[model samples]
Target: MALNDESLQELKAELLDELVKEVPSKTLLSLRLAETRSADIGEILEEMIEDDEELPAALSLLDILSAERAANVLGYLPGESQLEVVGKLDDSQVLKLLEEMGSDERADLFNLLSEDRREALLRRMAHREREDLKRLASYEEGTAGAIMTSDYVSIASGMTVSQAMMRVRQTAPDAETVYQLYILDSDGQLIGTMSLRQLMVARPGAIVDDIMIKDVISTRVDDAQEDVARIVAKYDLLALPVIDVDDRMVGIVTHDDAMDVAESEATEDFHKGMSIGQLEDGVSRVRLWSLYRKRVTWLVLLVFANLFSGAGIAYFEETIAAQVALVFFYRY
Candidate 1:
């Protein structure tokens, strides 16, 4: 039975009260007993977190929750809390949690994990999921293919609208989005595209070839993600198709994924340019000695460069003293 609004609100209030008391264990037990469904947990947590400032307690409660339950809760948490909870998860747990995340979010999280942890998690993941990750990870970190999802709706040109709808219905649950359908030829080359609205309005006997738009905008597999974002932004596209060397439709870069790529690339570049080490949350939380060690090499190199500049200045001291008036004139 669906939970009534009043009951849900009451349960939420109760949970919040317990959380405020700093009694996480009791709050966790109460939340579990409330029988709040997994699908509803993220929404509930979002509301609770917005109204309450006691996030540490809520995160502690999250630790006791199932992987799916914790994953859902983490998604609703504030950004810092999301990273914190993900950092606390074990490799197996991280893999399971990632399975529930969108491709772009998953890739971002993967980049934050330690190399060994990432490899171990990948090894434990399902074969197909591993393949998808491998394909995506193979792309340069700032490219469109790095962030695009392989899961999309596609149909053959020979299919009737009714047949295409049937296929969509069968695959809808697995698809990231179904607003647009790509039409491919027998060789799996992208030929055209059609929107869900078009499919709905067309006759059942209408062939996809007749409905699909022949002129389509697309990205190459190796295209820079920034360029993809510019193209999408220029055209105001919901998703940009990605094609291989043979013009075979490989996948698509969704708007949300493109946004993530932009954000990740921007963050990484900012850190690099600032001469600061990339601090994956876990890395940031390491011991002071470890943190210092990570930074020492860069500091040493910078120090030597500065020393060279000072020595050059010292070597020209006699020339400077002989031309002291020139120094004043040069300063002017």
Candidate 2:
């Protein structure tokens, strides 16, 4: 059963009780979490890891999950929590998790590792995987390429409907979304697109070239993530194809990823509106000193500006003595 807020809290308490014991029951813990959602499990783990003593318990909980489930849950965790968990694991264990993770998420976690650790992990990866990780991680942090995943279905420009369906079947299992399919030329440049439904209903012998939509909606690799999110939302696209200057397909930003970008952009704008500087993490996770530093500058300026009002009031003391009512109607 899906856990509600109250049930999640109850589960947290029960898990903590079990975890604090000298001999924790892994079987019981597994049963408790068996039906819980990965996202909720991540939240419970995050709260547990906040206390240094509870970290081992958190790690144990993660261990109880299958690699794929653990990777999915890890993706839901805050950056710091993710770092903490991975720091406790060996290279091979982390690599296994990375293999199960989505391409974009794997790149993100890789980017968060320290320089030496990154090198160590890179050396262990196969050639194709290592190159892909480096390419994905090389994009500027706020660009489309940074958020996109290379897991997308693409068909050759000249394939028949039957061949396109076969290609879809082979690639769809690994694709972020199979609703939309890209058609690429011999040179790997994106030329057209079609939906899975369109291909399925077409005559088996029909040429994909004749059935595909000639114009494809796509974004550049260097495009701002905010802009990519906007395009995805505006078009109601399941995924927006990301390309390079030469129009070659590189990756696709899925709708969920785009929504994350939109939410982050909105948060940044909200912070700016409140005269607060950008925060690297959520407000609750930021250090006290950093929070003070972000807020103090504008607050100090406002304090000094208030002094001018005091000065003006002093300047008008005699006038106020003659007309006390003027103070009540003061505009400044």
Candidate 3:
């Protein structure tokens, strides 16, 4: 079952009780967190890190988890929180966590590091992983490539159903979603797509090209992330394939990631509607001065606008004097 807000709060309270002990028991902490979800864990960590007194406990809690689990939970943290966690870890330790993260998320965390730290980490990484990180990080922010993950399953054209099934089994472990698969040619260009259900029901000896849908709906790498989210929602796709200028399959923007973009965009629009500037963090976590700065500009302008009303009223003083009842009606 999904955890509601109350349950999350309860979990955070219990964890905090354990974390604040003089010498927290690692074994007990591990068992307590064993069944918790990554997103939930991230939320708890965010709360802990937001308090200066509990920062050490938060770091200790992260250290107790295995590297892969830590990386998974770290992906759910906001940018500021993510940096705070990474700031406490050494270069090698941070690299280990980065290795376990998904391609897109890894690139994001890498991009957040300072120039010297990024150079240090990049130097220690393997050739292939390093190249992939640089390529993924090279994309402009707010673009499709920036949010897309290279971890997707792709079947080659002309492969038999039996062969394709075997490939799926091999790659699905790392893929963002195996429900939708792209079919590519020898030149590494996407030519078609097929659902996992379609492949399962087809004859083992049949060619994938014969069964795959030739006309695939896809987006370009340089497209706006907002447009990508719209396309995902419009077609109700589980994942949208992203291609480069050469028509080569680069990565995919999973539905969850696209929805994140949509929600963020909606929040930004809401802020604009209220005449508030974009906030870098959630309202509760944002600094008081930042909140004031975002609000004061619009408020000052509206104050000036209200002064015009007083000027008009002054000009109509004689008219109001003739009709005394109209003075009260001006409040409307």
Candidate 4:
């Protein structure tokens, strides 16, 4: 059932009460929590921390969730809360949570951490994950590489439907999404795409290339996330492949991630429209100077532009006085 505001608040209170109990109603709570949305659960944790009360209870909430789900909820929390909640957890806890986080999300969170904390956390992650994290985190913010996840389903174009299906099955567990599959050449270049539905219905003996759509919509890793989102939205794609300078496939930005990019871009535009600086973090958490830095340039430019216009008018005042009679007939 869809929960109203009052019901959601009650659910949050119930969870907080359960979490704060001496023994903790872990089992009973899980049964109830399973019915709640991750967004709502995140909201509960956020509500509990508005006054910074019940942090331990919030930690308990995080603990009850599996690593992946915890990461999902963590992504929903504000940056400061994310750091605070992670600070309460041990390194092992943090490691497990980060391991299960999406590649893009892990990079975003890792970028926010202190150097010492970053190194410590990186040390605990497996080698593959650590390497992937570095590669993704190295990309400039707002770029496709920074937002794309490396965990995508890729299949050889020559593989038969059966073989491709087997590969999809094997990769699904680790893939961020398998609903849309990329077809790659031997050199790891994305050549086309095939939907999971099409793959399933194709003849078992049919080659993947025969069924794959050759006109794939994609973006470069260095392209802006906004550009990637636009391509996905225009093409009604579930995912957009990321290619390198050499046209080799490296990752994909899933539809959900694209939607997030779209929202962020729209919000940024709104902020700019209001003449407020677009903040990377929420308004509550940004430093006074940081806000000033982002806003001052635009204000200063506007001031100078107006000053130039005023000066030009002042300089033309004598001419205007002489032409006062002409002003009335200056329609042309």
Q: Where in model 2 is the C-alpha error above 4 Å? A: 20-25, 280-293, 313-332
Strongest candidate by lDDT: 3
Sort by lDDT, top down from the best: 3, 2, 4, 1
Candidate 3 error regions (>4 Å):
4-6, 20-23, 284-289, 317-332
Q: After superposition, how far is residue 63 of candidate 3 from its true place, in Å?
A: 1.2
For 1-332, candidate 2 gives per-residue lDDT tens digits of: 66787988898889889877888898888887777889899889998888898899898889888899999999999788899999999999999999889999999999999999999999999999999999999999999999999999999989999999999999988888999999999999999999999999999999999999998899999999999999999999999999999989999999999999999888899879877777867677789898788889999999998898889899999999999999988753
Which 10 successive residues of model 4 have the least lDDT summed? 323-332
Model 2 TM-score is 0.90
Model 4 / residue 285 / CA error / Å: 12
- The number of the candidate with the highest TM-score is 3
Encode model 4's per-residue lDDT on 175-293: one tens digit a residue. Answer: 99999999999999998998999999999999999889999888999999889999999989888899999999989999999999899889888778867767766567678888787
lDDT of each: 0.74, 0.91, 0.93, 0.86
The local distance difference test score of model 4 is 0.86
TM-score of 4: 0.83
Residue lDDT tens for model 1, 1-332: 56776877786676666656644566466556447775456556655444446455556555567665666555544455455556656676677778876665566667666788888888898898888776776777667777687889999889999999999998787677899899999999999998899999999999989879999999998889889988887888889999988999888998876776667667767657656656553344557786677678899999998898668658877887898775555445
User: Global lDDT for candidate 3?
Assistant: 0.93
Clashes of each: 0, 0, 0, 0
